[model samples]
Target chain A: MNWMTTIFYFFGAITVLSALGILFTRNVLHATFLLMLSFFSVAGIYVLGNASFIGVTQLLIYVGGILILMVFGLMLTTKLNGKALVTENHNRLIGVLLGTVFFSILSYIIIFSANFEMLKSNKTLPENAVEFIGINLMSNYLIPFEIAAILLLVALIGAAVISEKRKEKQE
Target chain B: MSTIIFFLPFILIYTIFAVYGERKISAFIQDRYGPMEVGKYGWYQTVADLLKLIQKEDIVPKKASKKLFLIAPVIIFTSIFCGFVVLPITSSWEGTLTQNGVYFLLAIVSLDVVGILMAGWGANSKYSLLGALRSVAQIISYEIPVTLSVLCVIMISQSLNLQEISYQQGILINAFPDMENVKNYLFGISALNIDVTNWGGVFTWNIFRAPVLIPVFIIYFISTLAESNRAPFDLPEAESELVAGFHTEYSGFRWAIIMLSEYGMMLLVALLGVILFLGSWNTPLPNIGNIMLANWTTGEPETIAGNLWSVFWLLSKALMWIAVQMWVRWTYPRLRIDQLMSLSWKYLTPFAMFLIFVSGLWRLLMI
Candidate 1:
């Protein structure tokens, strides 16, 4: 009905399309690329929701940081001479059954969930909302913020330990 | 104006100028005549190059993945356009939705790495894969420092929203020197020496305020160079080993998108430098430009001159930073991968943590 809804639909379409691409693609790398598309579209959805900071962080950290790491790990460990890059499940019936079950559950919740209407409020423009997020992160979430620092340090050390292959003493 | 959109050729023409500028700049720096042959000052060289890329039969290698192979370029081009949304272009030169702008802008940006990774993997070549992997490692490692450094700014300014961050920085005057006098000026009270230069953050654009931030800035800028895939950190496509890096199999508009995304990324990193390191849209002096123009509730200055001036301020700052990046890129030789890792993990990582600690202290003591 409004501009925001229009944007939501557009991004939502892209998200679904990319998700479909992820499901249909055979190549692992191709699937990853589709996942990138899905991630970006979801970030767009975040922008639409007015949580611009979180959306950008999601992109920078997830697509840029984590996914890249996943792809790189795949590259490093992959035996390229192998026949097919894409891997799929042999049993489609069980897979489809599980997929349908999950899909049905989600749909049932969406359709049957009562007492709430999808009435949208023009809560914020994108830029203003981001500013508020910044404020809240500093003033309110300071503890979590400090904790995030410690977590990053732990991650850094953990990654170092895992990746650092101790050289065996040559006989 | 929509009329300007019709002149897409104008953008094309601007490409020629961009090429000439690049040539002329590199030439000047190297003390050579760069491009004098093609249409004087080699202005036509980029057009010539464009024509060449256009004429070259677009090739997709036989072994390459088809779907992702084609889509890679499209994603790059689309992603590059996203940065413009949040960036405040001159004083009054507001571009698009400034709200939720950081996410809209940065999300599209980080996606470029995905494109690079895809370009590498889709090529189905050893060189492509190697380059892609290196790019992945390099981007991820450097990203931590870059994010941490940016966090310092976010913490100091207390905003994740880019536009508001820009607004919050605004030129603050040091009233502490004359606090006794200033207080007098404010509350009709008499002069007290007060013993401070507005000691907290009223002065020094973060740099002057926290001189200790210099190391963090250095670490950040260095890692950011890697994050933007600049030289020294550009090990993924190191020319001697991998030909053209991950883009080896790419051709046609796809290659164009790749290059465009790259330059666009270069521009983004530089602009972010302007925001974080430089005073952003704020002038060095207090109360010189109209801060009110930044607040969107009041429409941007209606006059063309006013809007143009603000746009001037924003662009000038961004360009100055780009120049700095170029200077650094040309001046430094590429770092080896091991060296690069050591710099991030061993040096920058620890150094950034220390900077954060120091920043906290500076805030406690000064604020």
Candidate 2:
């Protein structure tokens, strides 16, 4: 159809393909990279859907932060004995059953409950989504926002304390 | 898309001259001549090196993972190149119309860490793996301070769009009538009785607009230095220790691509620093009484002359900073890993957090 639709389909295809690739790839490192690709494609879809702040944040947190940490952890843990790091799947029957159930539920929601007509109509989103989000967070969602901040602060302190205890034990 | 096309050639040419410039600067610092055999004043030395690298054998290590090894440089170059897409080069010529331009630039740039890791692990070398791990740790740790410092600018400017931030620092405020409140104050002081909306210069820049930002700018510069893996923060690629760090196994054209992206990262951070603190593309000349210097310097945004002036100012300022990066690189010895971590976490991060609070107070009380 339109260029935007074409681009959306392109990103969606990558997301799906990369997800499948991650599942099938034997090399653990390759799977991790494929996961990064899938996350990136999903971020692309978010940007295409006019949620750029969410898209960039997804990139910042997932691709940049978490994925780098994952790669770091993988490298540090994997013994480099002149061999590729490989993974083998376990509980295949249960995995397939769970995956099928989740897929069917998602498909059912899309097919039976979704309003395709409303999606087809050109409903304009906010011009400045960041400003809109910021306003809502400060005004309407202030209590929840502050609570989340406190929760994160607590988690941060907990991490520091845990690490400090380990250091003390080693001492 | 057009900006990408324009920037590809600009980056190539920039890398050429920057490589030569870095050599010459280092040579000057060491009291020795650098690259004397190429073109006039050794201007074509990097060009010759480029030619040589292009013809060299492209090498992939024997035991390396072929796929990731081959793709790592591409990922590294692409992620850094993508950062340029959101950067506003002139008042009228931003690459993309992203509302969250600053945030997008930062997020995309951080993706390079993934590529560096890929390069490191894919290389299958002890040196490469160690280098990549060190790089990832340093970059991840330093990002906190850099983001926090940038948050200070975002708080003061009240916008994340790079172009809007640029416009706020110039005589161009007349174009946005809604920003009258911001324009009325000179250096965030209404009592000055001097409207700096027409005055575009150092006085109107972010460092002066909120003087608390001076220390914030210093923190930003230092953190960015670490982010780009330049010295004295270049422990990731410490030549004495790691023999090129994460890119140790790369060779020929792939190595050239990594080098190009490394220089590109430097330019990108320098340009961002200019935009966030120095003044973006706005002229440094201010309008003194009866002088109209700023008016004479900056042209109308729609005009070709204006675009040229904007490009000239922005590039000159950014290039000056890049030179400073090189100067600092050669001046200071590479920092040890523990010192680097402590400098970032203990010093820069706390200072930046304090400045963010000061910025909040400044925004609340001053403007």
Candidate 3:
């Protein structure tokens, strides 16, 4: 395989491995960090696909922003021992059957997809992709950015109120 | 100039220097010498710290999740390093071997939020978790102002590419012989600009040409401090209360990673200050020849010397901003988490929005 193929395979393997690790990890905190690793390696896939902007965004939003929030949530809400947050499934047989079927379907899709030789080398950052998003965000899609801000604002206030509810309740 | 080639070492050196400088400056300000025993006035203190950290045994507490513990510091280090990929150092220098440099940097900055969170979780420490959560909230909340202020800059510059933005800035518009007589492309011989004090003398720095840059300057600098998780916004890692904050559980090399990453980020943000607000590599005025002939050579940058001079000018400008950050770090006390959030969401965001609106209006009015 060419160097490009090797790198691609490496990132892909890492991504898949991290994802599986997240799924299997019983420890809640461990799982969240694993999830972080999983998300980052997928971002690596985006980088390989020449979507560095999206890749970085994926890293920023998922790995940096979202994962941190999730970990914090896990840590704050859980007991001193982070491993105590485990919820063992009583229906292990059904869970295993369902997991196996899902894995089978996923593997079948991946195997078929691999046969297509979909990889094509394009070195230069495709112009209209990265700059165009920023342009569209400012010009055409300005309303969306504004709207997203508003949604975030509402969520912030809601989260704040919920956290502060105990103070009101006690008073 | 060769994109990644110029700034890769700079990122490493800046990170190393920031830690070294923070200690040295802090000690100096506090009336004591700091870490001088390590290496030449503590020049290699951070390096010694790194060696010590690496040699020290790794600790995974019995309560900690082993896998996540292994993963957390790597997460922190990897994500912060990503930011260097997009930094435009000089007018020519880009850290990444690509365009869409701004996007890359923005993405990388965003990733630090995750690192803090992961560190908290993986350690399974209460204080670490608290620090992590607070950080995530603080960073997310502050992101609004940061984005809005950057938006103001992007709107003014009309490009997202860091190199292009700096290159356009590097132009010595006032250096042109008939610069004063030159008509605006959008506006006619319009109302002669109010503040042309520097026009006759200082030549074409960004401040004079883009008046919006001044408020954008204030808003941008404040937002940069918040973005870098520097004091007063450093509530998440309040040294007094949080017990070393989010990376509290980290010892040895893990702790080193966190410290180095923080400094690297400080330098990155400072570099952004120089590139965005200050006339990056471009001298405040271009026509030093005129100044030299008139025996006023002090005002003009030393472009007559060589490329080395321009590099010096660029580094000097960047260092000035870094010093400002250092000063701010020393001067301010940490804010409360609530205070930090309110400052970003309530105050800074609205101000940035208003500034952007006014700037856009002002630009249109000029036309």
Candidate 4:
């Protein structure tokens, strides 16, 4: 295989391993860190696939933004009582069942719906993909984009109100 | 790959000198002689310190998480170093020619937050944990203003490529005939009949190209100061309150690595600021009437003299900003955490948002 294929496999392996690590790791912080690894490697895979704008955005939003906040929340909530922070696994059977079902559905969709010929063809994206993506977002995907943005705004306001109420109760 | 080869040694040499320079600058500010005995004018003091650090013991506390503790500095250094990959050093020499280069750089550099958190949490020290939390909060909050200000530049330049942004600031506008509208206006003023496409200098820079960007530049600088954890926004490492902050428990070469990354970050932001606002790799000297100073200073793109001039201009501008950062650090007292938060969320963020709106209007006018 070529260098690109080798790099793609490398990132893919890291993504899978990190996700597995997250599932198996007892320490909540370790699991969270592994999740970051998973997200980062997924971004790498996106870059490898020529979706560089999406890859960078994934890094920006997921690893840099969401993961840091997740780590912050975990750190603040965990008691600093000089003990290793660990979480107990519960309802393993049901969890396994649900995970398997979702995985199977995703695999089935990929196997049946996705064009394997297109994957093999390896068509490179436009040179100015950022501009292309922006135009598409503004014109073709504007409604979906606006809807998602509004949903996020609503979630943000709800979070603020909920936290404000908590402070009031505490006072 | 070649850029990485060049930058690795550059970073090493830069860190050594920068440490010494910071000491001398701080000493001068405080009216004290800093490290006069180590070398000629204390030139090799930081080198001596690096040697000492190398020889010292690598200490990991008994309660520390061994794996994460061991890996934290590596992660921090790697993340910061990766940011250099997207930066263009000269006209012909860029690390990567990615379309979304600035976005990629910003995103990768921010990943150092995870590494800082790892260092703190893995250290199992109260001081380290507190410092890390403060740092994460400060960096993340300041990032909004930084991103918005950068977005202002991207909107004005209409490209996310750092090299493209750099080209827009120089006499190279002739190479792109599509920028005819830009060539027609001098400093975005249609009333000014003079065309400045051939006059490469500060006049062609983004701040002057669109004057609304001046405040945006200021906001960017302030926020980047906080993003890099420099004073007066350096509550994370306020020595008085949190010892040495997130790396308090780290010792020897590990601590040195952390210091190296900190300086690297400072240099990174300064370089980025220079590229985004000031003319990147372009001579500030304008071609005045009957004198082609700008033309003389900025050599052709591929020639040896041109490459040397480009590297010189970019580094000199970036270093000037670094000197400013050090000056600010020594001059101002560290901000209180609450005050820092308010400054970022209450003032800088809101102001940056407004600037983005203004930038959009200005861009419309330019069109």
Candidate 5:
């Protein structure tokens, strides 16, 4: 295989393997780190696909910000005792059956979709995707962009309100 | 890959010197000679320390998460090295991976937080954990202002490429033909229009491009100081409070690697400030015909002379900033945690946002 294909497979394998590792890992901290690896590998795939901005954004927001927060939360909540953070499985047979069915359906849809042919063809992105994105956000996609901002503002306010109420209740 | 081969040795040597410089400067500030015994002027002190540190036993506490603890330093050091890959050292000397260089650097830099968190959590020590949490909160809060300040410059430059930003700063701000016309100019009263033909060199730096951006530049520098965990914003790693902070449990080569990475990051931020605000690699004077300063002559980028001068100027500017950082670290008392958070969220953040708005308006109306 060509080098591009090899690199693509390498990223794909890393993404899939680390995601599975997260599911199987007993320790919450180990699982969180595995999740980070999975996210980073996905970012690698995005970079390989010519979505450089999206790739870096994924790395910055997911791996850097959100993952750190997750790990921080885990570390703070856990006790000092070196306990193996394993959870007992309930209804494992049902979970396995449902998971298999879900995978089968996903693969069937992917194989038969009309967009499959188009996905096979490689299309080069614009040289200045960031500039294009900025112009589009300001022009055609202005409404949705503003809506996203408003949504984020609402979330921020909600979080503050909830936390303030908690503090009052504690007092 | 080849860049890494060349860069590794350079960074290794640089970290040694930087460590020595930091120690000597701190000593001088405290009214004492630092590292006087090791070699002439203590230049060999860092070398000796490195040798000693390398031979020391690598100890992992029984309670520590062995895997995470072992990998934390490697990840931290590697992430810093990864950042160097996109740094536009001299345009020609830049690594091949320069696409969206600023964004890439930001991403790589943020990865260090993850490494620090891992180190703190994996060590199974309360001090390390507390330091990690403080670092996380401080870095996250400080990052907002730093990003906004950079965006202010980026808004004006209209490009994410470091090379492009540096190239835009080439135009001189020499409104006056002669240097003697400034006698009557007092209290910021001068009609200095940006002149592309006559290079006013240092005056074309982003900080001086517009009056409002001066605040933005100051805010950026302050935020960088906090981001890199330097004083007076170094509450996270306050030695007296946290006992060496997140790496308290680490020893030997692992601890040395962590220190090296910290110095690397300090240099990284310094270099970014140079590129973004201080006019990267551009000399103070335009190339005067016939009578040139020989080795210090500015050349068109990509030529041999240009390459040499670019490295020279950029390195000098970055080193100057690093010295300032060291000076500030020694001079100021560490801020309290509450004060640090307030400085970031209350003052720096709001002011940065205002500066961004004002700079945008300035660019729109004036430029």
Candidate 6:
């Protein structure tokens, strides 16, 4: 159909396919890379939705920063032998049944929702959405921003303490 | 779109010359003649090397993952190519001036880490994996200071658009005294004060905007060195230890593509430095070649002449920075991995953060 619709579908397909690949891929490293692909495709979807700041932030923070750390942790902590690494999971039948039920419930709720029609509107964001975000973050969202900042600082100090304790134990 | 088409050849030819220039500079630093046999003053040395690389057989290691091995260079090259889309060659010249131009550029540039990781993992070698890990760590660590420094500039400009930032840098600080007496030169081609005199343009660049920004610019440049994996911070491909590092298993055309992407990245960093701090495409001289162009044109010669001058200045500035990178590479010894990490996280990051705070106050007070 239209260019926007086409782009939306393309990114949506990539996101879904890569997410599925992440679940199905036996190799842990491959799964991590697949997760990166999923994140990237979702970022592409965000770009298509005209929220470029959100899109780029997703790319910069998640794909670039967090994903690399995850990969490093996975590779260093786990050892891969000569044979292809395979992931083994138990309770497959119960897992599938639970997944199906959860999906159906979500779909049913989405279908019955009164505000579902809101998705049909192709309303665009303001051109200066970044500036708007900044203003909102400083004013209306100031409390949430401060909370997030404090939470992050606490996490940092917690990590430092844990590492220091571990070093002392090692010594 | 036309800019992409126009820039394609320019990027290729420029990469070739850059490689050649790097070789000659390195040789000069080492006090030896480089590539003397290939052509006069080694002009065709890179050309010959390119031909050799093209003719060489593509080799994929037996244990390597075929798909990832083949695709890694493509991903790296594509990421670098995408970054060029936002680079403003002149104030008036850019490919796509997206709303968040610099953010998008940085995002795409960071994607190269993914490609490097792919290359390292697909090769199925310990050395390759180690190199990739080091590179990813280096890039991520340096990115904090780099981004913080860029944020300082963004805070001052209050815009994410690269072209807007460039335009903001066009105002001459020295010309403040003459603002009342200076003639207005809007688009109407009226007599305007010579605010763009080379000396004034130098003073107007963001690096010179405030005393705090000078340190920020230095941090940014140091981070750029780390981000691009240049010498002193080039632990990723430390030849003395890892034997070509992440690209240990690559050969022939694929290796050439990786090299091309590396040079492309160097160019990207240089161009970004120009835009962020050096004032993209702004001529140093206030009234550049106005007298020379006046005799040939019936209409006002400002637009055409100005753009032409801007392009010349921008290219020269970017190229000069590239040479400086080469100089730094030859001058410094490589740092230890631990030292590299400390340089970024322990030093640059905190300094950059403090500078950002100071810059915010500076802007508030100045405004």
Task: Locate the minimum summed-lDDT window of 10 residues in model 3 chain B.
Answer: B181-190
RMSD of each: 6.5, 2.1, 5.7, 2.2, 4.8, 5.1
Tens-digit lDDT string for candidate 5 (B209-291): 55566788899899999988888987777889899788999999999999888888888889889888887766756434544
**For each candidate, what TM-score against the reference?**
0.78, 0.95, 0.78, 0.95, 0.91, 0.88
| Best of the two (4, 6) by lDDT | 4
True-structure lDDT of candidate 1 = 0.63
For every model shown, the clashing-pair count is 9, 0, 1, 0, 1, 5
Q: What is the lDDT of candidate 6?
A: 0.78
Minimal lDDT window, size 10, model 1 chain B? B181-190
Question: What stretches of model 1 exceed 4 Å from their correct place?
Answer: A1-3, A13-26, A75-79, A113-159, A166-171, B1-18, B31-39, B95-107, B169-206, B209-213, B251-253, B284-304, B364-367
Q: Alpha carbon lDDT of residue B71, candidate 4?
A: 98
1 or 5, greater by lDDT: 5
Q: Model 2: how far is B82 from its true place, Å?
A: 0.6
lDDT of 2 at B316: 97
What CAPRI-style quality would you assign to candidate 5? medium
User: Considering lDDT, which of the candidate structures 5 and 6 is the better prediction for this target?
Assistant: 5
Number of the candidate with higher lDDT, 1 or 4: 4
Worst 10 residues of 3 chain A by lDDT: A116-125
Q: Give candidate 3's TM-score.
A: 0.78
After TM-score superposition, the amount by which residue B4's alpha carbon in candidate 3 deviates from its true location, in angstroms, is 5.0
Give the range of the ten consecutive residues with the poorest summed lDDT in model 5 chain B: B179-188
- Where is model 4 more than 4 Å wrong at Cα? A90-98, A120-122, A165-171, B176-184
Q: Per-candidate DockQ versus the true complex?
A: 0.57, 0.84, 0.44, 0.79, 0.69, 0.57
Candidate 1 per-residue C-alpha lDDT over B1-367 given as tens digits, one digit per residue, 9 for 90 to 100? 1212322343344344545565666666665453656676666767777777776777888887766677767766566656655676544444455544444554566666666666776678888877877886787678778767876765554454455555434422221122233211111111323322222122334554445656767877788788877776778878888887888777766677676666666667766766665655555443213543323221244456545654555557666666676666666788898999999999888888877776766554443
